[model samples]
Target chain A: MEGFIIALFVCMVLALISKYLSIPAIPFYILAGVILGKAGLGVVHSDEISRFFSEMGLLFLLFFMGLELKLERIIANPSKVLKGGFIGLTIDMGIGFIAAYLLGFSLMESFIVGAAFYITSTAIVITSLIENRKLMFKETETIIWVTIFEDIVLIVILALLSASDQNLLFFFAKIALALVFMYGISYYGKEFLVSILDRDDELPILFTFAAVLTTASFALFLGIPETLMVIALGAALATTDPDAFEQHARPFKDVFLVLFFVFFGITIDFSGGINWFIIAVICSLAIVSKLISGMIIGLTIHGSALSGLEIWSNTISRGEFSIALAVLYGSPVIATTIAALVIVTSIVGSFTAKYSTWLRRGIVSRSRKKALMHRPH
Target chain B: MTLRSLNLPGVGTKYEFETDKGDTVAIFFTKTGIIQMYTLQKGCKTPSAAEMSPVEARRLGNILTGAIIEADQESVEIAFSALADLRITIHTFFVTPAVVGKTIEELQIRAKTGTTVIAVCRHDRNIINPPPTFAFEKGDAALVIGESDQIKTFEREIMVN
Candidate 1:
């Protein structure tokens, strides 16, 4: 507990540094964690308390994604959601598997690795997008919807992976039950919940936290993914009054999501236990694979490479989710390797978004120039 | 170098500032003092966005493209440093038959005080630099420009008690 508090204090100091320098703090917080954890100074351990905060962070991240994408919209566009979500996962996982297989890992290990690589870090990508003011871009909607779909698939896999004893069939059965449960509560129970809570500011926030706790606890009891369950809770409330829920729930979500990134950093083993060179080569390919996948997805929807670039630019970073997968599924070597990949990819992905505007303009102008040169004077 | 007005029908009046750096920004100014900014993506329009504060709005307004805001020269932004400098302030005195029959030259307002009445808002119309022959009506609002003290004194002398 003391170690966690000191770690929080360390994050605060790094945050101040980031502010003074006028840079985003997502990367800095992770770097700070690495420096403070056993990876560097051995100052802060990923204690049980920190682990709890980390899990809360994922729950809140997905929950807000639920808030933004809203339940009605998600249900309305099932085909669009599934297609957009499938593109990035299919590409990254394919790359992850092939890379792992070529590196002589077994089929199961390869599948685990591919699944882990399939997820883009919601925390880092969403945080960077908002901070850089790229949240208003035309492609932002396309990017977010795709990510929401990815997270939905991710949680299902997480549920399956976490409960090793349960077969996929049982998980699917539970999911069907959960969906029915979600539909009933969101459609029928919304008004009652809102009336019970009223418009009290603090209680709405408390209720949001309670909602997370109750659903997360139930998910554990049911052998389902807690991440998916909290998202369900948020979706239920979103179906009621999205604005009120957003106003109440955002602050709690923000604080914990920061802890999620830091906890991700603390878990990395920068010591010789991890193989850096092999992971670096493999991760670079994964990043390229993500971009190619995004481009394909964008093309399929918008019928233009430029639109594809939009999806690619926003969806390239694979952070906390990949790290979560690594910890759960990877052998010790692979898990540590993935941790390194998360840090590198997040930095690369965010910087891509940071300068995406410049890139877009340059490409547009160059294309125009080429067209002009070909035209008769 | 040039400002393009992208005043969409449903959207707010948007002004694009094309910079020498080749990057452009679209600022959507609403009726209320709210500013919505976009990165001006080439092929995309109407991106769902966030709002910036009035201070930022003003800064963006000033720096982006030269918007000649007539009243913003000695604006509150520079009002403290430009304290002694000439300032433009509109003092709308509610006239109840007070100097209702008066004309500008007859009033000798400029000769008596350093304040200049730049325009008059009568009902829905604005008559800028109203001719000396122009008569002041019951509800005429005078837009004056002068030093701070001069403006106050001019208001006091002309406004009905």
Candidate 2:
């Protein structure tokens, strides 16, 4: 308890600093965990409270993601999302998986690495775009869509992974049944749901909180993954009043998610023989793969290589989801490697994202100079 | 006149357009009902951005919808010439307590003030050309037509105390 309190206090201070610097707090939280946990001073251990807070953090994060997953938009433009998403899945995940496989990790470990590698930190990417004021740029749309695509893929990956150990058919059947049940409730109770949400009293907040917890608890009761259940709950609520749920649920997600990241960092065990070469290679591939995939997305979707460069620059940071994947499913070695990958890529990605414009300009000017020089005299 | 909207995933939807002034304006309506507006001037790299709460955004929307300088109340008054020298006017009045629950025939409005009650707007329902036996209710807006002075007399005597 004392350790958890001290850890949160440190995270709070770190969060303030990260906010002040206009950087994503995710990497910092993980790094703070690395410093405070078994790998560092060994002051903080994962207690029940911390673990529960961490679980809430991950659940609420997915719940928020599910709430924001406006299916209409994706349905409205299926081709763009598919093309960009497919290319990204193939390139980033393919590379991460292939490289990890070749590096002597088990196939499952490679799959986990590849999954983490494939997902760019949506939080980091979106925040940087708005902070950098790149929202108005033409490439910004493609960048945003690619993140959405990644989110969708993340959900699918999570589902597949959760169902891997169980009877696949039964798992999917249960999921479908749960989904239908949820949708039915949402459809039938739409008016009641909206009325409750519209209320300014504590009922709305309580309903939102209870709805999530109920879904999670019910999922456990039904032998369904609470992760999927909460997401389903969020999606069902989204049809009625997503904004209300988001507003009411945000306070819990915000505080808990901070602990989630911090505790994830704290729980990382690095004593399992560090592999620097493999870690360096995977980290490098994380950047290179995004660059390749982002460029493809740019050239094909946006018709500008420079736009691809811009997308690549913004997306290189793999923070929250990557760490989540690592913490949730990864072995100790995989966790340590991913933690390193996240710390390195996020810090490097921040600088690259910030100066991406300058990088693009330099490349453009250099190419123009070459064209000028190559012209017949 | 043309607007492009993009889904911002975890954020909300963003509607953007280049204004006639050649400045690009983007408005983001977040999933949580907060609104963020950004304007980028031509040839500028950065945009000026402002965030508004839902209430603030709605207030601004109301202003933009011209709620502040609403349609003039007199615009509701209709005037026409029945004869070259005589002008008839139509107007609306809020039914106060003095006129509430009073039937048109009982009030004898047409006989006393020479004004015909054209309609009674109660809540969302409008009673057009209300009958003589129609009773006025509190909160009803009575639409009447007559000579200007007669309408004035009707308002002074019937619509209010």
Find the candidate with the highest TM-score and give its number: 2
Candidate 1 lDDT over residue span B19-89, tens digit each = 67665675666423466787654445434455787887765655544323444232122233466654444
Per-residue lDDT of A14-46 in model 1, one digit per residue for the tens? Answer: 888876754457767777777777787887888
Query: Deviation in angstroms for A117 in model 1?
Result: 2.2
Candidate 2 C-alpha error for residue A181, in Å: 1.0
Q: DockQ, in order, for the candidates?
A: 0.10, 0.26
Residue A296's C-alpha lDDT in candidate 2? 93
Poorly placed runs, candidate 1 (over 4 Å):
A19-24, A69-71, A78-83, A126-138, A167-183, A196-198, A270-272, A327-331, A361-377, B1-35, B39-51, B54-161
lDDT of 2 at B44: 81
Residue ranges of candidate 2 with Cα displaced over 4 Å: A374-377, B19-24, B29-161
**How many clashes in candidate 1?**
0
lDDT of 2: 0.85
lDDT of 2 at A309: 92
